[model samples]
Target chain A: MAITGVLRPGHAQIRVLDLEEGVKFYRDVLGLVDMGRDSQGRHYFKAWDERDHHSVLIRQADKTGIDLFGFKVDSEATLEKFEKDLQAYGVTTKRIPAGEMMNTGERVQFTLNNGHAIELYADKKDVGNGLGYHNPKPWGPDAERGIAPTRLDHALLAGGDLDQALDIFVNVLGFYLVEEVVAPDGMKIAVWLSCSNKTHDIAFLRHAEDGKLHHVSFWLETWEKVLRAADIMSMNDVPVDIGPTRHGITRGATIYAWDRSGNRFETFSGGYPAYPDHAVITWPVEHLPEGLDYAQRKLHETFLTVFS
Target chain B: METQKGNTTSVMTEEAYEYVKITIAETGESFDCSTNESVLEGMRRLGKRGIPVGCRSGGCSVCKCQVVKGEYHQHRPMSTEYISKQELEENCVLTCCIKPKDNLEVKVIGKMHKNVCEK
Candidate 1:
């Protein structure tokens, strides 16, 4: 089976506030086998997957949001073909500097359908040799091995211009809209789009204000693994914000929890399949009478209005 | 969306009554609040109005807090679909969703308004 425009299941890319600290957490504490550090100290890690190089990359930055998410295609030819299709759709595309592309370890840059950033190239590094430098007195634990993640699942972004963003995603990137929720004033509030069969590989929320990455998703083996992970969190005394519920859009039962650092995480399983082709669906925004706000409606509680 | 005015309700039932002693870690101020109000609300009531809360719903994860001591009950279940169950069990409760079930103590985990201005 050749990879398509869709991201391989479980591939997630995130930005970290402190690169060095993130390395200690993911490598030393969690025990993820560190692939190696970039010249700038950007660290990469591979999970229990057969992919050549790192599945997750963390770069140090003062602020955090979706830095970039990469999708695996069958070959460079597939990537070039997708690029041409994007141009035909009137979506501007950029070639990444070879350096910035993960394994390429060189400069490379690319812009996707909705102006979302991407870096595509091939150069996975080795993980076992000098790559495994010992920071024995590392921050977390010596014996701690990160719970092997299956893959980097999805990325969620909060955008101000929902319609425009959705248009680029559908027309240019060849993604399908799975489901959406509308605001009472007839504005799109949230949308779930997919480039793969596992429900949605990406989701966008119309922020009441600006655009930013909301959160990211990672899929585990089963519902039991989700709960077992929850129990581990309980044993570690981490606070559980919400969960063990089914999502209305994906129909996937999942849990929302946070890590020690303030970032949010979702562990989900059994989401519905995506549309066969790139099917774009739009829902007009309209005001809901009284019990219409999905956030309040579904949860039956008043969410604090902090965006304004 | 309709720009509705904020409404306050004074109704209280025995089941909705839980007492919590909250200590603002940043300022070292302590106050008591009823279960009817959230931790952020309780902070507001105590005049330590520096906590920045947007999207009072658990969706934002902005009003995040670390439980220093005691158990707090969430008014409703949070969607693990966004945040993970592991994070919740680690004692990272959103102040907006949290209602005191006991005499609880908490620490605001994220950047506060005062911290933002200092820079």
Candidate 2:
């Protein structure tokens, strides 16, 4: 039986606010290039690597959550087979026609068993002309040449039922468990799952409220990039959520910042790989008791006054 | 079929006599659990602890697992309202309501990695 693709070899894709604004932030601020867009007006950007059409796709969305996550499968046939399999399971699957999006590759998409949307496609975009790195062009005092992001690292989402979502991703969708977090109140809060050796391609967060997309992360070429991104955010007066800290699981150094539209983004360096036989690890929520405390310090610093 | 003295249904099937071996990841040992018993009950009977079971009903997926190698059917229809059917096809079965018709190998799916101290 042909299994659905897991971590197909490629870069990450994202949906952004304004195409021009996103381009300015990624290209002018972060120093990336406009790889191009598809018929749907989705913008594609590339890093220093000149191997493909565009590693990142930023589409304009009216909303502020993650629109979808794309993973490359081994072959186009695998994509087709997954489409059939998903149909058999009564999942509503859609095939994006070539040229409809920035990447001309065919893609099959469906909402995950957990409500998060996912796309599996064949990426055939051109590895553009190799543009090497540029110098430390300072956009501000904090602006340093941001480290080039290698690929889409992972997306973090907050949902209500983590176990149900995890089962869908791990069992039905072919993703593997990296680790899980359970709070003291008997609530299973977050889960780290992946398709490849990298610790996790997607991390699910279960908060007290309704489920929503938390953030999307990209892998930086070096630790310097993470610092530089932090500096850029600080310089631009963007709200910094947390970070330049190391996660206990991925152990990667990360910097978290909000975009112009309040979407959270992270630039990180280094993470573990994912493997089939690797034992799934679990961490008690008590270890990090702040409760999804991305910015624990900030929460304690102030309280809301109704009129103010 | 008659009612048992304790108001329990006495309609037992030959399938109840069939032995189903369950391999719990925590214990790394396989135990002989009857087909009529839920996976959670089997674990409890064997004195296996730390499985993080809550809300014995399927409403809570704390007892979820990836059925690696067996054909255990759920006592009630599996609901995709909470988890998608695709996930169920991928071998995710809630142990609280599943009845094994054959030997099964299941890996715990949620929060199985929690530190023993937290449990």
Candidate 3:
């Protein structure tokens, strides 16, 4: 078995305009399982298959966007090592005590060059996915509710310095650039990266702004489920941004929609497998039409400009 | 639901408010949306929270609401994707810029539209 020091996207702390409404949208519409609220009034939710207590944390704020994106490390020692590595790299690192995030453990928080908060943690209470591990069924009743994604898949963020961010993620975090779109001037327009075998565990776009969230993506089981997610969004009156189509970048079926607070979230599924040894795929910035949406082949204006 | 005439109420102030009664179909809760503003603005100002407001510039249409019964004038909506022409012709309005011409009744489609969001 290979080492996955940084396991996966554990949680995303997102801001919503209203807590109750956010709860309604995330729980009833997005079909995530609510893990109860903390003293800070931050709400916790997890996809049906997630064993960790929560993968999505939302707090009510005057504005909409992300506060931090967290990845779970393999162990506490790995988390500590990453923190020290970040400090050695001249990045400021802070520690959030365990229990600060309810069932979550101590987190090493650091800010990226373009102003996005990132964190690594080693522990969180596993509240099993409703099904018992011994002779458990394939799915539960919760799986059929709302737009039930199987798990929190990845995040797409926008920031100005892709080179700096890439250095940190590759040198410090063990992520490999699987695919990238470059400008004629040799600047990276966007990057798709992976830590495990999946195409992209997280991605970033070159933007004029620092610390903007493009979208927090959830993994559905299949393309059919992606379509069902779009169906659920429409049934609930959620405003969609794009898709119910395929993305040319990851070859993933997707639907980008805004939660009630205007923050973008994606229901995504089906991307090709990626390996660390694979050659990095590149695209010209001019070909963003097919690089973005395959069938439409139209680069959406809002896709680039709208970020929370 | 049939449209019914509602008694007009107003509060005289530096920012005079036209009182339009709004009933949330999902919750059966009623509030005044008569700030002479977009239904989204009036909803916010009236302290009727939970209605999502995005790009208050009338872009993004995250605040689309269905008019159960009311009359109001609005400029061209930022996009017809959220509230389609058919829906608009059927009395749907964008909450970001809905100005209630009189006391009226309406339901919020911001969280609950009929079809599965696909046209």
Candidate 4:
């Protein structure tokens, strides 16, 4: 297989103001399958197509933001190798024991220069999508649920020190640069990196704040699913930041909205498949307005300033 | 008889609603805020565009502001991470979680303050 390490985004633990409200919004509106709550009063969920035990977790907290983002490594050996590679790269790593999170193996966690926590782990219980592996059905009941997305796609994190952060993902983690937006002075305003065939597995923005989350996006099957998400958000009164439009950067159809607790989430589809040998695409800062919203061609004011 | 009944219904509706005017300290923009809804909700409902609308709950701390004049009731807690207890005592509040008890003059203090005040 071409992809051998850092398989995909495994899970992200987000903090919400109210537990039940967060649960309803995620379960009903966002349409992730509920995997039930843990002993710590934290609830877990997985997208309809994910075979893992969970991909999203929520806990009640006074503040709101992502707690940690995790990537599933191909094997325990790859996890160990990355831990050593990160440490050798002058980045300190911490090993969180297995069972700390339900059905999760030991995790090698480290803090990025931007004050965000990133974790890598190799083991998690595989709970198959309702359709069995042999002679599987095309879809199931969960597919018909509210705005159900096939998978958790990518996240754009905002903070300073992106150059240093890029080193960790590119050099140590085996991710390749897919696209970037550059300032006139040649400073990179934003960068999208990928670890697999997806255009971007994660992206970063240059901002004054540390550990800021722009949005965690989910992948839909088509452009129609993205439009359906807009309808669902309107019906529920979810505050939409932008979209139901296309992004010139990845050419992905998108809609950015906030959860009940103000954390931004995206439902999107369509982006060209990326390969390691592909050339990196760059957009100048002046063209960012068109890059962000290709259809509207307006760089949303809130897109730059507001963040949880 | 129908005219009297309609007049009584209108009076009851007004009595049931309690609205307090809120003035933005920077722009002098004003809006009527109902006692039942947060200031951010009133601003959004009236399309005031005074403050950056955030989670209409206490969580994001995006709609943070300080009441420079008059009084209000905080419907929930503002995490000390954004506003300390001392700041809360000084009338600093998250507009999404506070309702004006009387006419108030508030200054936007959150990250998007420039969008509201400068504009």
Q: Score the docking of each candidate (DockQ).
A: 0.05, 0.01, 0.05, 0.20
Candidate that scores best on DockQ: 4
Count clashes in each candidate, considering only residues at least 3 apart in sequence or on different chains: 53, 11, 4, 0
lDDT of 4 by residue, A1-308 (tens): 88999999999898887788788888888899999999999999999999989999999888787888899999999999999999999999999999899999999999999878999999999999989899999899898788899999988888898998899999999999999999989999899999999999999999998998788899999999999889877666666778899999999999988877778899989999999899999999999999999999998877887676
Model 3 global lDDT (CA atoms, 0 to 1):
0.79
For candidate 4, the TM-score is 0.91
Model 3: lDDT of residue B49: 67
When only the first chain is scored, the TM-scores of the models are 0.74, 0.80, 0.99, 0.99
Model 2, runs deviating above 4 Å = A1-4, A8-17, A128-145, A184-187, A207-211, A289-308, B1-119
lDDT of 4 by residue, B1-119 (tens): 01111100121234455888999888999998887667887888778887877655565667889889987887655544566667777777888777778888999888756233222
The models' CA-based lDDT, in order, is: 0.55, 0.59, 0.79, 0.84
For model 4, the superposed segments whose C-alpha errors exceed 4 Å read B1-16, B76-79, B112-119
lDDT per residue (tens digit) for residues A101-202 in model 3: 988899999999888999999999989999988999999999998998989999999999988889999999999999999999998989998988899988
What is the Å distance of residue A172 in model 4 from its true position? 1.2
Candidate No. with top lDDT: 4
Model 2 TM-score is: 0.60
Candidates in order, TM-scores: namely 0.62, 0.60, 0.76, 0.91
- Displacement of the residue A289 alpha carbon in candidate 2, Å: 4.6
